[model samples]
Target: THSGTSLGGGDDLGAYFGLGTATGVDRLEVRWPSGLVQVLEAVAVDQRLTVVESGLLAELRPLTWPIEIGSAGGSFAYRLGVTNLTEASVEVDVWLHIEGPKGVSITRGPIRRQLGAGSSLGLTGSQNVPGGAPSGAYTMTLKVGTFPIAEQTASFSFSKRRGTGRAEGGGCRPGLGRKL
Candidate 1:
């Protein structure tokens, strides 16, 4: 995270909220080069996995994907913006996972069927990147999973034309172009 523009890493990796009071709270032990020592504890306790705490003033900054794939009254066109200064409201379960190209999958569930409270829901949805999903860089996990109590994890990953006639750069090139 050193050269990632900003975010120093703590407040348990939300990096700090409202941006203050996280001074030198370190926990280091990721050694390698042949010394070997990392049984676990980067950050994940895993009890069926749940970590609910997010009045987190801000962190998911992605604006204007602006619905780039729309047809047939529009099904899901990928317009995920984010901002919730927190009063109370967040039910984000956007999980559409499809992997192929030696990593297989034809479906994965839950893409914002419903969510409301405290606002900020530009999370449009879509799936079926499966033209035999095996070309390259195919790992889409919009898996917010009610994440951090839904205060964050307005997840990301775009480019859903999944090329075969080979048109992988921007948009509109896979056949059947259905309802968004």
Candidate 2:
């Protein structure tokens, strides 16, 4: 919405002596995408677009992936924190997809689940932490899906300390991203 007014020379500011002044008006015109043009009698103005909610990106946070390995076998677990951007309740499918390190094959864990509106889903699913897994960087995917509503993703890296067997924090990037 815009409102503008023009100042006539009648309200002269520095007009004295011969007392002659000038007033100027701006002409506005817009061309629509449909090849239609619209002209209006107006002056200079300002315009912009602001996103008020639904369009805003939701907040997605994932805890570092925890992995354990021993004689009893190995296990993995991770959690997701969801912050609904919309005022109303929304459903989100948050899950983990872990790829086993070279020479190690994981057969279980990592599944899909939903999140409640304006809330988050904390998942602690147990999975086999690959044995003799190379103690280097690991690639993991933490995804949140809300069909017909919203989709969010968190891609991150975590390191495993061989002797201590603890995972370090390397938070993922924010935003619902491109495919895969």
Quantify all predictions' global Cα lDDT against the true fold: 0.35, 0.39
lDDT of 2: 0.39
In the range 1-180, model 2's lDDT, one tens digit per residue, is: 112322343433221122134232243344444433333333323332221223122232333333334422344444445455455665445444444455443222223444345555443333344435566555555545543222444444544445544332223222222211
- RMSD values, in order shown: 16.2, 18.1
TM-score of 1: 0.23
The candidate 1 region of ten consecutive residues with least summed lDDT is 67-76
Tell me the spans in candidate 2 whose CA falls farther than 4 Å from its real position: 1-73, 100-117, 132-136, 146-150, 159-180
Best by TM-score: 2
> Residue 76 in model 1: shift from native, Å?
11
Error of 2 at 12 (Å): 39
